[model samples]
Target: MAVSSYMTDAIKIDVWSDIACPWCYIGKRNLETGLAEVAGDADAPRVEVTYHSYELSPDTPVDFEGDQTEYLVQHKGISREQALEMAARVTDVARDAGLDYHFDNLKHTNTVKAHELVHFAKEKGLQGSMKERLLSAHFVEGRHVGRIDDLVELAVEIGLDADEAREALISEKYVEAVRADEEQARAYGINGVPFFVIDGKYGISGAQPPAAFSQIARQVWAEHQGEPAAV
Candidate 1:
C-alpha cells in the first residue's frame, strides 16, 4: 500500500479590496467563511485566495480625525442620522462575521501610500501580515496610515525593518504597482470595494453572506473541473 496526499482540485479567487472600507473587511471575513465551508463542503469544491488592491478613497487626508460618524456627515455629506444608521448596519454585519470593528475610533487616512506599501510587501512575502496590520492600525488603533513614519513603524511592528520600510515609503517604490491595481479595477468597472473574481472570469461584489459567496464559488469550482485541457 502507498500513502497519497489529499490532492483535490484548486480554485483561485482574486479579491480586490481597500482596508479603509468597512465592507471590505466584512467581505473578507465572509469570503473566508465561504472558502472554509466550501473546503469542507460535501457539495462544493476547495479553493485558494489571493488579495488584490483597490483604494476606496485615494485622495483622503493623511491627518484626518478618526471620527467616522463625523467624517461621513461632514465630508461625504451623509446626514447624522443616516451616518449613525449606516454605522449600526455595518456593525451588525461585522459582528455576524466575528469581527470587532472600532469604527467610532477608526482613523480615516488616505490609503494610497498604504496600498503602495502592500504592493511592495507582497513581493517580500509579507502581504498577509502587512494587510492585517495596516487595517488593524487604521480601524483599531486610530493610527494614521498615510504618514510615512507611522506606516514604517507599523511595518516594523509586523517584523519588517523600519528603515527599509521608510525607504520604500519615501522612495515611492511600488507606486506603479498600486496604480496598476487601480487601473485594473477601473478596467473591470469596479467602483466599489470587496469585489471578488473567480479564475479571472466571474465577478462577485459586496459583503454578501457566506452562503451566497459559497454558492458562487462552488459553481465556479465545478465548472473549472470540466473545462477542456488548454492546448
Candidate 2:
C-alpha cells in the first residue's frame, strides 16, 4: 500500500521575522495559537504558514562584543537605562505569550546565516520546524545563529542532511532567496516584523492577539471561497 500524506485546503500565510527579535517569537506563538483555533473550527479554513527572512540589523558583527542591552543602546542611540527598560517590557510580553526570554543572556549577532538556514529548510519542506528551532535557539538557548558551524548543528538536530545544509550555506545557495524576500518586503513597505502576508494580498503586522488572527483568517477564507478559480 502507498503511504498517503495529510493535506488541507490551506490559506497561505507568509511571515517575515527575525530570530533575534523577541516579538517575532511571540508573534510566532500567537500565530500558531490562531491557526490552531481556526483548524478546530469546522467552518474555518486551514492555514499553511511559511517563514521568510528579514534582517533587523544586518550590519551586526558575527562576534558582537556586547549583550543585547548594550547592542541596542549603541545601535538605536538610546541610553543604557532605556535599553534595559525596553528589554524588560518585551520580556514581560513574551512571558505572557508562554515564552521564557533570557534577555540577559541573549547572544546578539547577525542573523543572515540563520535566515539562510531557513531558506535551505524551505526547499526541503521543513521551514516551519526549522524556523521554530532557530528562534528558540537564538532567544531561549543563547546560541550563535550567525555562524555556519553553529547553524549546521541546529539544522542536523532537525533531521536535515548536515553536509547538504553546510554546503548550501558555504556556497550561499539560498542567498538570492533571502534577497528576494527582502526585495518583496521593500515592495510591501514593511519596515518591521513579524509581519504576516495572507494569500499574498492581506497584510497583518505585529504580534497580534490570537483572536484577531482567527477572525481575519475566517473572513479571508470565506471571501476567498466566493471568488472563481483562476484560469
Candidate 3:
C-alpha cells in the first residue's frame, strides 16, 4: 500500500461546544475513544483537535439563582418533572461515557469567560487540558466557570500562570477569538453542538457513538489515499 503525504500529516479536527453542555463532554469522550481506536492502525494518521467556543446559553447570568432543573424549566419551557427526567437520562448517558455528572450540583452560567480561558490555554499549548479541566469542574465539581477568579484558579490547576490567566480573563483578551469561533460556527450553519469539522471537510453533529467517529476517520483516511473506504 502506498502511503500518501496526507496519511503522514495530522488530521485537523475543530470542535465547537460549550462548557455547560453535557452532550459536548460526552461527545468529547466519544471522539477521543474513536481517535484512539483509529490510532491503533499502523497506517492511521494522527489527529489534532481544537475546541472552539459555542455558548448554549449566552444570556445566562454569571451567578444563576436556581438549580439545573429550575433553569431547564424556565429556559426550556418544560415542567420540573420533565426537566428531572431529562437530566436523569443525560446523566445515565454521561455515566456510560465515564463522566460523573451531578446535575444537582451543576451551576449553570455564561461560558464566555471560560471560553476565553481556553483560548489563553491554547496560546500556551494546553488547550486540551484546560478544556477538559473546565468541563470536569463545571459538570462534576459544580465549579463556577463564568467568573474570572474561578477560571483563573482552574487555569492554575492546569499549570497556567495565575497572573497571566487572570489578566487575560479580566481584559477579555481572547474575546474576539471566541467571537470569531462563534462567527465561524454560524458560517458553517452549525446551530447546535457538539459539532465537529474533521479535516476541514467532514461534518459530524451531536454526541455520536465512538464507532461512528472511528468509521469516519477511517473513511477519510481511505479517501486521502485515493482508495474506496472499506464497508
Candidate 4:
C-alpha cells in the first residue's frame, strides 16, 4: 500500500536548551507531553526532535565556588532569600510536570563540554536519551556534568561506549558542533534557553503548556496536508 506523505514526512522540532537550565528540563517534559497528546490521532504527523546546544552560563567554572542559590545571588544580583524563593517556585512547577528538581544538590558548572557530549550522542542516534540523562543528573541527582570523566560515566549508563565518549570529550571532537548550534541560535536572534523551532517556521520560547505544543503540531500537520504529496 502506498503511504501518504503526511504519514511519512516528519515535522522536525529543533530545540535549543541548556542542561543546566531548570526551565529547559521542564520545557522538555512539557514538549514530550504535548507530542504524546497528539500521537494517537489518525491525522497526526510523525515528529522528529533534535536537541541543539545552548549554554545558559558559558562562563561558569567547572567547579563553581558555591551552590545554585549562591550562583543566582551573585550572577542575578538578587538577595539570598529571593534566590530561595525563586528556586521554590521553579521546584513547584517542576513537580507539576512530574520532575523532582533538587536545587540544593545541583552542582553549578560550565556546560560547554556537556553540550559537546550531546553533539556526539546525536551521531550515535541517542541524543534524546543522553540529553535526558544529563538533565536528570544535574537537576535531580546532583551529578557533575562539567568534567570529561563524569560525562563519560553518564554516557555509559545510557549504553554508549565509555572509552569512545571519553575520547570525544578529551579530544574536544564535538566542540565545533556545539559551537555551530550556538551560532545558529544567535543567527535566529535567540538569547534564551528552552526555545523551540517547529517545522523550521515557528519559534516558541519558554516552557509553554502542553496544549500549546499539541496545537502547533496540529496546525503544522494541517498545513502540510494542503500541499501535494511527493511522487
Give the best candidate by lDDT. Answer: 3
Q: Which candidate is the best by TM-score?
A: 3
lDDT tens per residue, model 2, 1-231: 121122235788999999888899999999888878878876668678888899999999998999988899989999999999999999899888898888777888989888999999999999988999998988888888889999999999999999999999999989899999999999999999999999888899999988878877887776656643222
> Per-residue lDDT for 65 in model 4?
88
Across residues 16-126, which tens digit of lDDT does each residue of candidate 4 receive? 999999999999999999999999888766889999999888889999989878999988999999999999999999999999999989999999999999999999999
| Alpha-carbon TM-score of each model against the true structure | 0.86, 0.92, 0.96, 0.95
Residue-level lDDT for 148 in candidate 3: 89
TM-score of 1: 0.86
Q: Candidate 3 has which clashing residue pairs, if any?
A: none
Candidate RMSDs in Å, in order, are 4.8, 5.0, 1.8, 3.3
lDDT of 3 by residue, 1-231 (tens): 346555566778899999999999999999999998999997885678999999989999999999999999989999999999999999999999899999888998989999999999999999999999999999999999999889989999999999999999889889999999999999999999999999888899999999999998888777776789999
As for lDDT, the candidate ahead, 1 or 2, is: 2
lDDT of each: 0.79, 0.88, 0.93, 0.92
TM-score between model 2 and native:
0.92
Residue 100 miss distance in model 4 (angstroms): 0.3
Q: What are the per-residue Cα lDDT tens digits for candidate 1 across 4-32?
A: 22325567788899978888888877887
Better of 2 and 4 by lDDT: 4
